[model samples]
Target: MSIPAFADISKSANDLLNKDFYHLSAGTIEVKSNTPNNVAFKVTGKSSHEKATSGAIEGKYADKSLGIKGRVYLLLPTCHPKKGVKLNLTFKQSAFHGRAFFDLLKGPTANVDAVIGHEGFLAGASAGYDVQKAAVTGYSAAVGYIAPQYSAAITATDNLSVFAASYHKVNSQVEAGAKATWNSKSGSAVGLEVASKYRLDPVSFAKAKINDRGVAAVSYNVLLRPGVTLGLGASFDTQKLEQATHKVGASFTFES
Candidate 1:
């Protein structure tokens, strides 16, 4: 499995379910179910002017008796030749997880990655050797620690980017975090961002962030039903002293 230069929430149900649709601009439909044998599955499709049409199917099979679990996904794009097809496979058990992944639009680029961890600490690394295959051709790794009150991580990539982030749970109602990155290859520093979230109640929360780029943003999320959620977000560009963007979206889930 090749590690992606960036993350794509659409390719995996875990990521898709975690997405904050506050700034989302597309319309999406998703269905999730489980087979009689306990194989879980999810199917999601989205449409938008910028993205056109795209869909993905993901499945997970876990054998508690065997102490192993596996997941696979296939994503289809209705437009663009390079983004038309993609596949991913992941396997996990106890302290280790492995994946064999790749994409087509580019020369045959494949990546494999592994992570070792327990409850409080984790470490992982990945590599792609062929530079001509993709602009993301390089290696990257990360290590992190988590506790009830605080968590921190450090990550670096052969692309000459290094970053560190940390978060602290100040109390039951508030949590704060910040991250900074530097790209040695670009000979410049990436923006530093500070973010925080506040729990309004058991079912609602608000989040806000400010960055070195003079951008500030905020979002609010709430549960509308047991399986439905709604979110709204807006951002302002201080440099322009104007609203940059605003969006609202909702998601629903169903399972047997």
Candidate 2:
């Protein structure tokens, strides 16, 4: 990064002058004159923070999962008579496995949820559905809204909640639910999630207690005949939530 060629100074209540994070991106989108009906792909690469090497344990950085992320999105143009704009789908992916041994313990029992941010999450927990026989997992998904530079929301944009789901697999049985998102306020990112899950552990006993709301089970995983990585991060959220509540855990991608 170079010394900024430009600067925007702001005054605080104390009249003290403070400099904000340096300017990195120009907030603009370009549309070609050729194709108007379709949206195309776009990519941006920048350094967020820098550090060197090793292992996965907890959060994003502290455990050694620090590096730049390649971000992606879709672009669309306004038509001759059309009002407003259109956006193609977007997604975020990471290179390591994430872990959370502690239960969200308590929160909405429903199986699906969403939050406004760069990553949408999915999750499910079961106390002891079945040991050596049952496997359970939670699931969630979210799309980061108002990219930081283009939209002021990066600093304070309620990320639009997109979609969510949760599921479990045991023996030969799979139980899952689907969810949708909605936000009444245009400039803000708020959404509702809905879903349900049913489980049967016997590999032959594909049945749920019918009376159970949210499920919990004992889960343990090991991957490296190879490597390890760990990163830790936390944030203070200022979201206006719907009376329907949710739990915030980690985003996950896995392998044997």
Candidate 3:
């Protein structure tokens, strides 16, 4: 669950923060099958860097593996032009929060349940998007074992059968839950950097290179829409080590 980012994506004391919206994915799909047998056509064009990923530490663009890019097994979009129904489904690696120390990596022992969920308009646009989570992720219980399929199949499965309907369970397989929670948390932190990346610049001279190091930082964000947000932020970053270049930054941002 803990995706081992190939490199430290976070800035040290004086790295740079980029303000850019990254294309997590851009793909096209043509329904090969709908309803009944339930199959469809999907084509995806992702970063060709082979090991590239969006929002990596190198900047807010495609960089090396910050962690394994979530696998894109199936991508689908649905909408009712007449009634105004909409849906979005994507499959990618969901990161985990855990660590490897003394040569041992410990984390929530659960495998990333291959996932399939939908969020869309159940009513008018005024109703906004109704999101849903339909996956089988087991957790530990006092009894020692509790399958995601246990106690509450209805809650996890959302009334529809496990492997039926437009929405289906991926059954991606489960790892032990013992450390899954922590690993997932760490991986999720990568998204929090949108808040700030504090950078302090130092005066420099070619004859004598002084402190080249910058500051590094982290922050959390919460929002109902990308167009706007309200969240907490903190950072520690340093100016470009070279001191020859300057980076432009906004503590917060809006499209306008």
Residue 235, candidate 2: alpha-carbon lDDT:
20
Q: Is candidate 2 or candidate 3 better by TM-score?
A: 3
Clashes by residue pair, model 1: 1-100, 1-101, 1-111, 1-112, 2-111
Residues 99-143, candidate 2, lDDT per residue (tens digit)? 222223222122222122223221211121122333433333222
Estimate TM-scores for all models.
Answer: 0.68, 0.15, 0.16
Per-residue lDDT of model 3, residues 96-168, tens digit only = 2122111112221222212122221111000111123233333211101112331111111222111110111
Candidate 1, residue 62: the lDDT equals 84
Error of 1 at 89 (Å): 8.6
* lDDT: worst 10-residue window of model 1: 8-17
Each candidate's number of clashing pairs is 5, 30, 40
Candidate 3 local Cα displacement, residue 193, angstroms: 2.2
- RMSD to true structure for each model, in Å: 6.1, 25.6, 21.6
Q: How accurate is candidate 3 locally (lDDT)?
A: 0.22
Highest TM-score among the candidates is held by which one?
1
Provide the lowest-lDDT 10-residue window in model 3. Answer: 121-130
Q: How much lDDT does each candidate structure score?
A: 0.62, 0.22, 0.22
For model 3, what is the alpha-carbon lDDT of residue 98? 25
